[model samples]
Target: MKRIAVGVALLLMAATSAIGAGYTWKNLNPIAVGT
Candidate 1:
């Protein structure tokens, strides 16, 4: 049970990082296009 909890926490962290990267890319893309 503890192992399963740890696995889920890792998955959540990975997903959050992906979302953060995508959001950063989206925010930067418009400036890049404008330039």
Candidate 2:
């Protein structure tokens, strides 16, 4: 039970961090860049 809780906590942390970073990128530039 404790291990499962820890795993979920870590997963949430990782997901939030990724989302935060991704949001930064997207907000900064949501433009398609290719030529």
Candidate 3:
């Protein structure tokens, strides 16, 4: 059970990290604050 839990955790981390979306998101941040 511990091994399975560890594997799932690793997969989730890898997937989350792989989500780049190729966006900087800085533009949206400045716009939201009226900068």
Candidate 4:
């Protein structure tokens, strides 16, 4: 049970990080191209 909880937490963290990175790139790409 403990291991399962830890695994879920790690998965959520990774997913959030990936999403954040994608958004950051999306926000940056237009400005980067414009420049």
RMSD of each: 3.0, 2.5, 5.3, 3.2
Which clashing pairs does model 4 show? none
Model 4 backbone overlap count: 0
Per-residue lDDT of model 4, residues 1-35, tens digit only: 99999999999999999999988887889787567
For model 3, what is the C-alpha lDDT against the true structure?
Answer: 0.69
Which digits, one per residue and each the tens of the lDDT, describe model 3 over residues 1-35?
A: 99999999999988776664323354456675465
Better of 1 and 3 by TM-score: 1
Alpha carbon deviation, residue 4, candidate 1 (Å): 0.3
TM-score of 1: 0.78
Q: After superposition on all CA atoms, how large is the RMSD of candidate 3? A: 5.3
lDDT digits (tens) for residues 4-35 of candidate 1:
99999999999999999988887989787567
On TM-score, the leading prediction is: 4
Residue 17, candidate 1: alpha-carbon lDDT: 100
